[model samples]
Target chain A: MPNLYDLAYDLEKGLRESAEFQGLKQAYDAVMADEAAKQMFDNFRQTQIVLQQKQMQGEEITEEEIEQARKTVELVQQHPQISKLMEQEQHLNTVINDVSRIITKPLEELYSENS
Target chain B: MPNLYDLAYDLEKGLRESAEFQGLKQAYDAVMADEAAKQMFDNFRQTQIVLQQKQMQGEEITEEEIEQARKTVELVQQHPQISKLMEQEQHLNTVINDVSRIITKPLEELYSENS
Candidate 1:
């Protein structure tokens, strides 16, 4: 029998082979292949990271920053490749969410049984 | 500028550095270090995978199998190392859940803005 880590790696490989994941990878690659789209996505991601760090530190987000984020999001969403990437991400997230629940079912059953 | 995949890799690295993850790793190592515990855990995992596959195939599990699984979970839960591993897994899961939400916040914000 394979070890738990080995099983996890197998699961990862299975996910990579899944259509949803493949779609996501293709969409991501498309965005990266376009220099302008890549730049926009990177800027959006940097802004996202900064906001995340601030929120984690309990710092308030400013109105101006929020406006900037909104604009960046709008611009990115309007880009064909970036928009496709986000759509593919959502599709892959759905599959991942189902897999997560399925994987944890055994634990849920065990705990519920004993409790 | 770093790409989205690079940022994701950084997030993975950060998760590994977290105390919850560290605790989980130590607990996992403890269970794997004991030959008997490792054997028992592997058996439980194999049973789990079988049940998972059966369910995925739309087959109902036999009552006897359910009972067997219940007993195995109980036995493993009683094992010191296995129990510690489960406890640590819950802690790491909590951290992972939070990270999932945080990482998706950018998309969430963007969607909410347009909607």
Candidate 2:
């Protein structure tokens, strides 16, 4: 029978491989669900709607009106609520990084010992 | 000026010492706040309350009633919700343990390299 250390080593190797595959899947899902990207797309759609609404109202698109719309888009992009959410996302990323560091400690030790 | 490794080492040492102190404080607080112990004490108090309530009602306490009350106390002590909470606590402990292991990897590497 294989010793406990050998069995543990094999299990660790399998876990690392599975975790890598899972990480890739998670990254793909995150990109697909990115709130910031969705918000920006929504802002663009809203601009189109605003222009359409103005046309229906028989309002001539003036340079000043166009400039105002541009500013509104910028404001939407830089919304305080979005900024706060981004900050929270960054904080969560930090926590996840810390947790990842903790999980990888034993592997690093094993590498160092073997080397 | 200290090298990056030296600075990192000093920072790690300080963090470890602070974390150790925090862990000790948390353990002390956990012992003091033990819900199971509190529940057992409450059960004893409830028994006294029932005895008083019976005397006020002019009802004689029988051995069977006392035995039934003891079983109720046992059932309260063995509440499923408390067991579920304990399981959740154990799961959280596992996560914390995993995180701690990851965080300590670099230190273990350094130790192995120095040795």
Candidate 3:
């Protein structure tokens, strides 16, 4: 009789050990090593979060704001190291998403029944 | 600059430390301590996986199979410890889902733009 938490711990350990996550960590370290790039990324991330929060709250984002966001994304994507890190992030998130999907299947079933 | 992976690790640590997860672990341990309950839970889980897989593959589940699955759910719910564990699982998963949603906010924005 294995406790589910033991299995949960194993899953966490597996994710931490996965190559995708390791690559993400490496990219993150690279970004941290460069001050200019780090600042740029942080700024972009803050703006992104603010915009997302606005969207989530049903607040209307102006056309100017949308264009500004697009420009910030363009700038962020132009930085080689930062762009690479973003790519690695996308890859890592895909892995996490797969793991989450599998672990939450039971919850999905339960909720679907309720819905 | 704080690396994204460091933040990701923090999120994992937070989840592991959350009361919901701890409660789930406790309930899981309780179920595991009872041999008969553990066996029953395993059997139900196996059936659940098979049925889910079949549904995912677009195979029609017979009425009998549906009834069989319902019966198993009812039986599992009747077991106090197992029912409690299931409830804990639901709560823990809700916490995990919220964390995942927050972590993947940037990805959502990226994808929404592409779409």
> Model 2, which residues run further than 4 Å from truth?
A1-38, A41-77, B1-115
All DockQ scores:
0.03, 0.01, 0.04
- DockQ comparison, 1 vs 2, better candidate: 1
Give the residue spans of candidate 3 off by over 4 A.
A1-115, B113-115
Clashes by residue pair, model 1: none
Docking class of 2: incorrect
lDDT of each: 0.68, 0.48, 0.71
Ranking by lDDT: 3, 1, 2
Tens-digit lDDT track of model 3 for A86-114: 99988876766665655455446533432
Candidate whose lDDT is highest: 3
Writing each residue's lDDT as its tens digit, candidate 3 over B62-92 gives: 9999999999999999999999999998887
Among these predicted structures, which one has the highest TM-score?
Answer: 3
* Candidate 3 interface RMSD value: 12.1
For residues A1-115, what per-residue lDDT tens digits would candidate 1 score against the true structure?
A: 2233333444454555556666777777777777888888889988999998887655789999999999999998998889999889887677556655544443354334322
TM-score of chain A for each candidate?
Answer: 0.85, 0.37, 0.90
True contacts kept of each: 0.00, 0.00, 0.00
User: Once model 2 is optimally superposed onto the true structure by TM-score, how far is the C-alpha of residue A34 displaced, in angstroms?
Assistant: 16
For all predictions, the C-alpha RMSD in Å is: 15.6, 21.6, 12.3
